[model samples]
Target: MQRFGWLFLTSVGAGATIWCTHFVAMLAYKAGVPVTLDPVLTIISLIVAIGGTGIGFAVATWRQNRLCSIIGGVLVGAAISAMHFTGMAAYRVDGIIEWRWPYVIASLLCAATFSGAAFAALGTATLGRYRIPVGTALLVIAIATLHFVAMTALRITPLRLSTAPLDSTQMHALGLATALVGLVVIATGVFAALIDRWTRSDAMQRLHYMAMNDALTDLPNRAGFQSELARQLGVARATHTRLGFVAIDLDRFKEINDVHGHKAGDDVLTALAHRMRSEMGRHDVVARPGGDEFVAITRFDDRVQLVAFVTRIEAALKAPLSVGPFATSVGASIGIAVYPDDADNAETLANNADLAMYRAKSEGSPAPCYYDAPLDELIRDRRELANDLRRAIDENRLEVHYQVQASIATNEVTGYEALLRWTHPERGSISPSVFIPIAEENGLILPLGEWVMRRACTDAVGWENDLKVAVNVSPVQLAHADLPRLFHQIMLDTGLPPRRLEIELTETAIMADRDHALHVLRQIKALGVGVALDDFGTGYSSLETLRAFPFDKIKLDRLFVSELEGSPETIAIIRAVLALGKSLSIPVLAEGIETGVQLAVLRREGCDEAQGFLLGYPHAVSAAGPSAFIDGPHIEPLPDADDISNAA
Candidate 1:
């Protein structure tokens, strides 16, 4: 019903424009003596105008489709021409009013041409309501073209009549009346156009507001934060000022939300946003990028001032938030990266700040962490290493260095563990920890893992001793559904015994996707390949995970082995893990045994196997070294930078 109402209104508007255009042109016609309109005929012409317009509106908008509009437009042009000619016939003079036949034809053509243009303008969908002004103007042109051209077709001759035609004064009065009504119609069109424009502009403003703001907290969102950060960064760079890019995350916010409902979570976020804003200066920017995450751009004169500001914010955030009837307490972890000190651009600054925040969260400290230069260096070096690793993998520059694993009781090399070794032409030696994560994240782990597996199988086939080759598989690789199939294909192609090719995984990897990991591990076990749970005792629910999977070997994480000498608690944990492995009938291997002391402890603890620097450094399969395993080995642990040379 509302749709029809709008259609009716549109039809009336269109009819008014046409009627006014024709009448005004009629008023402009001066026959020099006297002229009047036939009242009945004039009324008939007005009805024709309204009726024709209604027909056009009904058909064009009936389907609201392009084809329908075009077809309706043609019919509308014919209706407009018919109405113009009907109005022309109503014009009265002292005698019969004649029209020049050629001029009449031209007038009809003009009416159809302009009326079709007007219909096409209105029907156009791409000309959004924003084009109302231009559309109205086009309609005006259409009406004017039809009316004036038809008026030009009139040819009147002076003649006396006993019925006394309307005088000059009466004619002028009619003209004035027509002009008044015409002005009103045009005015209405202009007013409607302006209203449409304002409406569209208002709607656009609302969309922009929604885009830049968080709906829940009414604070600036991530997009808004990036915009503000860039602006501030520009200002700081121009003025030589150091701007602090602080990334803040509400700690344990999930726990609070889980305890309460989501509505309470919204209330807490709003409260936190208000608190953050309250602590900001006019120039500072505070925004929420995501759930319980906030970023602020602040100015500081020096590092000390920045530290003081962070302290003030940390203290402010410690206060409990009153949400509904409950007071919810939440702490904040903050990371600060100084512009012109840590990074000059917005993205780098935001990333550095986020890294610092994670570092602070990991430390479990109350204090905020500031991004230091060494962290930046570490990240830069890691990025460079990742690039080099990609190239190394592509060019077959990566070497499969084999390290010896020996029985704890016999002190004889039982087998060799295949390790990926990269000696960059520029950086010399890059550790697996440094580049393996890079490989995982960049999706290079798949091909790299495959290469290592194939190389291990190929190398083991050529070994003088019928020893097994243990290869470490990344969590990324373990997640692949086709890993077992790929492993089977490698063994089939290399002709290496599946039992001799052991695939090692950390507990983190298995637990990452339990169902898929279990499925893949079972598939590998079905192929008669050895499955070792590497870094067993470190991850969560270690014992539970151990009982879940049928692992052939359990390699203890190096952390426990490193602390074995100094900490009794560490010794006790290792003993417990060893005992658990023994009870489960899964052989336990102690990794990172650097000295005879650690080996002696493991031997007494009933460790089945051990491997570390004390066993031998990882070397090329063809290289002759003590990698086969040596007994009674003793040496102090090397520093981390140099330890990568020997430590597996």
Candidate 2:
């Protein structure tokens, strides 16, 4: 709106000046003066008027110097004079008429009046400082001088008795006076406009600073920081220089605010800003992005220079601060990201820096760390997997590959654990370790998990009556809104008995939201679906949580199973867990068994069931149940320490 107002004022002023100048010239020609050179004079007047008006308008629009307006006025007046003089010279009257003194005097007076008026108008429009009274006085004097000069130039041929003799001395005196007055008028108008423009420009500049700068520390604020960051990034990219941005979050700043009050906090922030400014180079930018958050952007020759710069800032921040009467110290954990390295743009760089800063804060380190490819790759891979998992839902690429669980006493398959697998088109056979967390992070587990549940149920319905299929559910999936509805749909779609479908959840999955998890588990249990606690020994191993949710079985983590024979402590812990599960009427299943000795120990400890490579390696869904590996002399158990030492 302000810009439009400036344009409107300039265009109207220019048009008005051009029209008025032409109208006055026409009027002059109509007033009995020879207009032989009127066309050429008018053309000159039009150019001068348009050019002066354009210059004045431009100066006003830019809010530049008043000298521009003054110069414009002077040019306009000079142009008018030159045009009038040229027109007078071009006069060619083919008659016996006398060159009257009155006619010459009138022409000069008219020229002076027109020139002075135009100059004064331009000056007043452009200059904000000078008063109108002084300008008017100058204009009057300029008009009087022009009239006198014109009269002096006149000569009467064939002088009548009424015509007094032309006095050269008087005429010369009059002409000199007119020239002096005209010069004074133009000079005054120009000078006044220049002074006015200077004063207003200074005032505006001060206002602009106040608006852009922070009040407390007089540093740039968040908005200003964004603008500066963009500008600096552009410069760095153009110059092929390294641009570094560091996001600094003051450690324990909240404590200071809580103890000393907000006023003291403000004082500390101001002092800190001063210190930061002292530490920064002239080309660097430092800004307070938010409460207790400061950001710095600097150009460096390379990564090493950027690291050194960050180190210096970290060192400076470690120094003690004196806020009011209290001497306090605070440390800052800074996250450093370089342009065209960590990110290609401003917002991405800032976001990545913030991520790195949080990582630093979590690690409890004051030292700066550069953004590494591994971290970016980890995030990128997770995002890609999340997207792929979503597509897998539509394409039916997600499947539950079965691993047989066997009973040692009967040497028969009790059930099969349904492990989820994804075969990506480009990157084939993605591991559960990689995509499972991704699924949880992106909430893709809800739909993918539902599909797993439905597929497992359908597979189980086709299998022998005794074999059950256990499908693992992520914590996010368990917390889903339609969990019970999904279970019911799966049972109906597969025409599988509810007892044949078992849902497995980790300790973290159940403990994440105990009430919600328990409620969902109870709903499934009510439908006659068995619920197993997967990886029970790891995560939140609370007896209260176990008692809250009525789990049908507890699958011990592979970590505990792997060390059971080597560590008596691990064996004892597993025994206790197994005893607890039995007491609670929950069957304990040992996982990752690899040899007869481990299997024998689990059996001796009275474990109910086991699943591992020793029993059967995980197989495709189309494969038959657990393979039979009889306990014979040819199939020797893994050697113990004594046997190995004796052999050596």
- Give the winner by TM-score: 1
Clashing pairs in 2: 145-178
lDDT of all predictions, in order shown? 0.78, 0.70
Alpha carbon lDDT at 628, candidate 2 = 26
In lDDT terms, how accurate is model 1? 0.78
Provide the TM-score for each candidate, comma-separated: 0.63, 0.47
Clashing pairs in 1: none
Highest lDDT: give the candidate number: 1
The sequence of per-residue lDDT tens digits that candidate 1 reaches over residues 90-131 is: 766676567777876776666565656666667676888844
Off by over 4 Å in 2: 1-232, 237-242, 245-335, 340-369, 373-395, 424-428, 479-482, 538-540, 564-574, 622-648
Tens-place lDDT digits, model 2, residues 48-74:
544544554554335444555455444
